[model samples]
Target: MTIRCAVIGLGMGRGHAKAYSEHKDCQLVAVADIDAARRERAAKEWNCATYTTAEELLEKAKADVVSIATPNALHRPLTLAALASGAHVLCEKPIAMTAAEGREMVAAAKTAGRRLMINLSYRFSPQSQVLKNLVDGGALGKVYAGRTVWLRRRGIPGLGGWFTDKKLSGGGPLIDLGVHRLDLALWLMGHPKSTWVMAGAWNHLGSRIGASQGKSYSVEDLAMAMIRFEDGSMLEVEAGWAANIKEGELMETRLLGTEGGLVQKNVGEGYDFQAEVFQERNGTQLDLSPHGPFPECKSAYHHFVEAIRDGKPHTATGEDGVAVQELLDAIYLSAAEGRPVAMGATTTKTGAGTG
Candidate 1:
């Protein structure tokens, strides 16, 4: 079956259009962006119809699948509208500004009998899949604690635009970058219920940039949080848009388990990553980086299409997005109130899908 696909919000959605256009079973029918020049450029590049608004694309494009990558604020409404239009949706991460909004979108997708997959890109990585297989297969023993970090030096995106506006982007790197590693860590740890969060955020860099450049910057440049899960495990997460770190960009996730451990990190301050498993054997510490016996995993976009086509359980569903969002919301709240925030049972449901 040829799946008709449309992409909304050309910033990151441009990649979505490319992915869909490259897929054999999918046809890129249209793309939408409020920016006229960007929309035109995207249309020319993807060779698809262009729209000034997602509503127009949804009404006229008739896509079977839609990728929503606009901004943090547009996720919920755009996802709901796409589902209502009988299109499976691949929404960008953080799901929405709040977990409540994510839950609403999930329910709407359920009611409409459409699939909603959150674009948690890290989980789709080959390294992540290898780590996940080991963790899930008990090679990592009982996972207990983990640490995830994504730091970049002077990498604030769209400095004076929606990304810097808390009202539009929800939070800074915590939501933008940290959420990817957070979701990957949680997925590897078997999706534990986040019980509480203690966090702190600083806007020193953003404030300085705003003052110097006379720009509007209202979000944090760096944010850190420690989350406690119901299973007695904990995850330490940190994300920074602008920091004094030595590396240009550093993304790492380390999970400590009872019998073994795993670490996945970027290679040489770049997007290329490698993961290794740690174990103690014969009074020696053994580090193993599995290269074979496991094939390369498919892309998240391809997985979403396969899930819709085969009726399989999709990874990074709306439920998983909500779980991550709840964690983020708690982290932001805790940072703002200068106290630990306890997550509600309703907000911290286990498993994906209907949770």
Candidate 2:
């Protein structure tokens, strides 16, 4: 039973369309993008119908599911629209501007009786899966700390385009890039309750460089935070577009536990990643790195299809997205308020604090 799917926002939506087309149980029936050239190109490549707007595409495609690779700000409205239009949705990460928005989208999904999956693509990586297995198997006993980094020497995108604009991206690299590692760490740590956060965000890197492209680079180009969990676990997160780093670090997540440790690092400062596991063997230091799989987000694409077909729970649920968003909100608040931000307790009304 092919799950007919539509891909919207053709920048990365093209990849989503191709993944759907390749899946035997899924069919890529249509593509949509506001950019006419991009829309036509994707339609021709995928050999499917195309629309210039998601509303129009949703009206005509009648797909069972839709993959929304739109900008971060558009996530909630588009997901709600798709669910309301009788289609399940797979929206990209950093689900919405606020946890409140994320929760609203989740509620809408429930009201519409539809599935909502956030594309935290890193969680579905084969290396991530294997490391998870080892951790679940107790090879990494009593996980205590994890760290994730997505630094680039000087790789800010869309110049003045939407990437830097807070109106569109909500924040900056923290939401855009760090969110992936945040999800990966929490997922690996069995979703520990985020207790509090101490963080800082800096825009010194991008603005100091020069005038950027179409959008205002008013947000931070770098953000660093420390997250405390209920179980006494901790995660250190660092991400940025432009930073004073010697190495052009792409992405890496490391887990340190009582029994063992696991780390996946970019081998050549790229998507080609290498992972290592450290275990004790009668006092001998053991560092192991098997031939890790290449970069592929298809697993997530396929998961959405099977989830819709089987009516089963999707891997990255709206609740998970909300949790991450809640943490992100806390981080930004911490940076702005110049104090620790409490996650579980802090809210708009309460005089609660995270520090």
Candidate 3:
């Protein structure tokens, strides 16, 4: 049974299209984008039908699987439409602009009886998978604390465009880049429920650059947060699109547990990553690194298709996306209100200050 796939928004959707086209059990049936040039290019490259809008593609493409890679604000509506159209959806991360929207999307998918997966792409890396296995195997027993960061010296993307616009892209790197590391940390730590968050955000450099370019930028360039979880585990998160850091790009997730500590960090300020495990045995410290013969790392699209076809669990689910969205909301609210935000039956600001 071949799964017919369609992709919306050709920017990151191009990767989706490529993955689906390459997968053995999937066929790239259609693609949609606002840009005529992108649609034409995708059509020529992937040999698929093209549409001007997501609505048109959903109406006529007959796709069994759909990938939503549109702007942040469009995720909820597009995902709802796709689920209603009886297609399993693979949506890009942060789920939606807000946690409420993410919940709604998850509910819609359940009602439609379709799979809704998020493209938390970073988890698909081999290094991450290995570390996840080790953590699950008790290499890191009872993880108590972690620090995850993705900092770019000067890497604000599409500075004046939708990426920098809060309405269109949600917040800045916290949602864009930070979500990846945060999710990785949480996944490795067994996804503890967040209890409260204290965060600070700034847009100093982005706003100045946008003003000088006569463009509107309304999102933070740097965001830092400390989160407490129900399991007594704590996480420190730092995401920056532009900073005075030494590296052009720096990404790392370190977890400290009762038995050992593990770190997955980028190599040479690039996408390539290396992971290490540190433990003390026989009164001697040992540093360990995963070698080859690692499990096959599958792309998010491939995992989504496999989940749909084989009833296997997806690497990232809508619920996971919602969890991340809740943290993001709490972080933003905490930053804006100058206090810690508590998550419970309902979210509320706490009297405790960042002090």
Candidate 4:
């Protein structure tokens, strides 16, 4: 049983197309992009049919699996259309612009009786998988707190385009880069229910640079937040696209537990990562690191395909995406209101000072 796959939005969708083309149980049937050049290039490179719009691809491709790699605002509509077309979906992350929209997408997938997975790509790293295994196996015994951060010296993407526009891309690094790290930390800690958040955001550098270059930029360049969970656990989150930091790029997630602590951080300002675990053994300090002979961590695309084919559970479900979206919404609201915002309930009474 071969799964026919189609990809929309050729920028990151190209990676989706390549993964499908290489998977043994999948076929890259079609691709779509508004840009004619991108469509033509994808057709030539993948030798697959191309469409001018997602609507046309869904109508004609007859694909069993669809990948939605469009802008943040378009995620809901495109995902609804794909699910309506009877194809399981693998949507790019942040899921949607709002938690409400993410919930709607999840409901639509349920009504359609099709799989809806979000492309949280960071979870597929070998280091991440190993740490996840350790956490699940109780190696980190009752994790209580964590700090997740992703910062770049000067790495604002598409400065004047949809990425910098709040309406199109949701927000800046908090939604783009922070979501990945936040999800990783939460997943490692067994996904505690968040209770409230206090955050602050700034748009100093991005706005100034955009004004000087005669470009429109309306999102914050940096955002920081402290979140509380129902189980008395807490998390500190920080994300920035432009900062005065010396490192060109920095990424790290550290979890503190009753028995031990674990950290996964990028190596040498690059994508390469290293993980370490610290604990006390017989009243002596001991630090452990994962060496060679790690398990195979498949790409998100391949994992989605295998889950659909084998009737197995896949990571990063639509519900997981919504959980992250809820946190994103709360953080932004807290930043805008300059106070702590409570979750789960409708009323937003002040809790702690945003200091």
lDDT of 3 by residue, 1-355 (tens): 9999999999999999999999999999999999999999999999999999999999999999999999999999999999999898999987999989998988898788888888889989887888989999999889999999999999989878899999999899999999999989988888887898999999998898889999998999999999999899899999999899899999999999999999999999998999999999999999999998888988889878877788766768888888888999999999999999888675322111111
Q: Relative to the unseen true structure, what is the C-alpha lDDT of residue 99 in candidate 2, on a scale of 0 to 100? A: 91
For residues 1-355, what per-residue lDDT tens digits would candidate 2 score against the true structure?
Answer: 7788998898877778988999888889998888989977886787899888899988999998998898888998898888889998888888898899998988898788887888888878778887777788998899899998899889887778788788998998899889988888878887877788999998886886646433457779999999998899889999899988788767888999898999988888878777888999899988877564544443788887876676666778777788888989989999998899877663322111110
TM-score list, all predictions: 0.96, 0.93, 0.96, 0.96
Selected candidate, larger TM-score, 1 vs 2: 1
Residue pairs in collision within model 4: none
Cα misplacement distance, residue 197 of candidate 3 (Å): 0.5
Span of ten consecutive residues with least summed lDDT in model 1: 346-355
Name the regions of candidate 1 deviating beyond 4 angstroms.
348-355
Residue-pair clashes per candidate: 0, 7, 0, 0
Question: How close is each model in CA RMSD to the real structure?
Answer: 1.6, 4.7, 4.9, 5.0
Worst 10 residues of 2 by lDDT: 346-355
* Model 4 C-alpha lDDT per residue in residues 1-355, reported as the tens digit of each score: 9999999998888899999999999999999999999999998998999999999999999999999998889999999999999999999998999989988898899899988899989989887899999998888788888999999999999889999999999999999999999988988887887898999999999898889889898999999999999899899999999988999999999999988899999999999999999988899988999886888999999999998888888778888888888999999999999999998663222111110
Residues 1-355 of candidate 1: C-alpha lDDT, one tens digit per residue:
9999999998888888999999988899999999999988987788899999999999999999999999889998899889989998999988999999999998899799888888999988777788887898998888888999999998989888899999999988999998998999988998887788999999999879877988899898999999998889999999999999899999999999998999999999999998899999899999999786677788889988877777777778888888898899889999999999998968745454521
Q: Which stretches of candidate 4 lie over 4 Å from their true place?
A: 345-355
